[model samples]
Target: MSDLIEVRNLGKTYRKATGLFNHKEVIALARVSFTLQAGETLAVVGETGSGKSTLAKLLVGIEQPDQGEIWYAGSQINCSEYRKTNQFIRYIFQDPARSLNPNQKIAEILHAVLRYSTVLSFDQREQKISQTLRLLGLLNEHANYYPHMFSGGQLQRVALARALILDPKVLILDEALTALDPSLRAQIVNLLLELQQNTGIAYLLITNQLRLVRHFADHTMVLHRGECLDYGPTAKIFANPVHEFSRKLINSVQY
Candidate 1:
């Protein structure tokens, strides 16, 4: 698969209050770059404040970058507006419980997405909703239930269904698995890999979970203090890390 997403020279800075009238510019991400192919998983591992979330926000247009170019499916997107990438890129938050609307039934939630993103008729939208729910291991009956009715694992499946409904090219998971228990996380991981194989959707998994990174990621990019410290195949990074920080990181995790 060719590169489905290309990021080049991305940079982001935030200005925060330092004193009464003073502000300091903090660089959250700096000239970071990478590429993701169709059906591939690129795990971005970094400690807190390491720019992982910043990168995710930038890619999804939650925040505008200071300097960078992001190309998705061969089209350069305006990082300032999420609508520009709505059809190709989607984001699944860390807390699946909170990502969904607690007030809306699952069917209503899914229908809203279809209503805004597609031209499908009401019947078509209903059909698409059932299809998407089933695709994510959810049932049509569950569609009548509220987000609160499901367990943590089921909530995640609902969230995944919401994202998959769009047929996105890349699904950016910002610590998406951290909130789940190990068993659920493993199930979600396997489901994600299966979805990748079946749908050819790329995944950018941003998290500090090294175990997940080591096992599932095709390539891994390490970040430290907003800088790219190491990057390449997961096997190479584990067998022999290039940066000392990476060595320490890999050693911190078992297997």
Candidate 2:
């Protein structure tokens, strides 16, 4: 399979005020490079402030890198140009409450996305929405309620449904399941696997959960201090990690 996405020598820096008077430059990503083959799911694991989110932002074109490049398909994408074509890339954020609108009913929310992406008539849109909702284990009645009316797990399902409704080629999940209860997390993970199997969409899953990565990811990358300290097939990396940071991360996973 050809590479669906390629990131090369990516770097980003943030200027910060030091103490009360001086300025400091914080490097968020340093010479990061990787590739995602079509339909492959890659998990990136790191502690907080490890630049995982920064990398996600860059990949999704929310932030421009100071150095290097990101190529989607065969072309190097200009940030703005990429955003214009971003229908193929969807982001599932960490907080469902914040990601969803409190005022919009689930039906309205999904209708808007379908309206934007496809030219389906009202009846077709409703049919699609109903099928998508059921696929995510959401009841048809729930679609008439506000976002706040649902549990955290249900809200996350809504988020996933919204993303999948677009039929995106790639989905970036930034700690999306971390906010859910453990059993709910397991359900969502299984849901993700089912979606991938059915649709063959690529996933750039960012998480702090090593256990989840072990169970769900095809490949895993360990980030530390803005660099990829280790990465490989999930099974091999977990079985014999060479880097101390990677070892610590693998050990930290509960059971």
Over the stretch 27-121, how does candidate 1's per-residue lDDT look in tens digits? 99999999999988999998899999999988888888899898877778874546857877899999888778889999998889888888999
Stretches > 4 Å off in candidate 1? 79-81
Q: List the residue pairs that clash in candidate 2.
A: none
- lDDT for every model? 0.90, 0.89
CA error at residue 102 for candidate 1, angstroms: 1.1
- What local lDDT score does residue 136 receive in model 1, on the 0 to 100 scale? 81
* Clashes found in each candidate (C-alpha, N, C closer than 3 A): 0, 0
lDDT of 2: 0.89
TM-score of structure candidate 2: 0.93
Give the per-residue Cα lDDT of candidate 2 at 19. 80
Worst 10 residues of 1 by lDDT: 79-88
- TM-scores of the candidates in the order shown: 0.97, 0.93
Off by over 4 Å in 2: 19-21
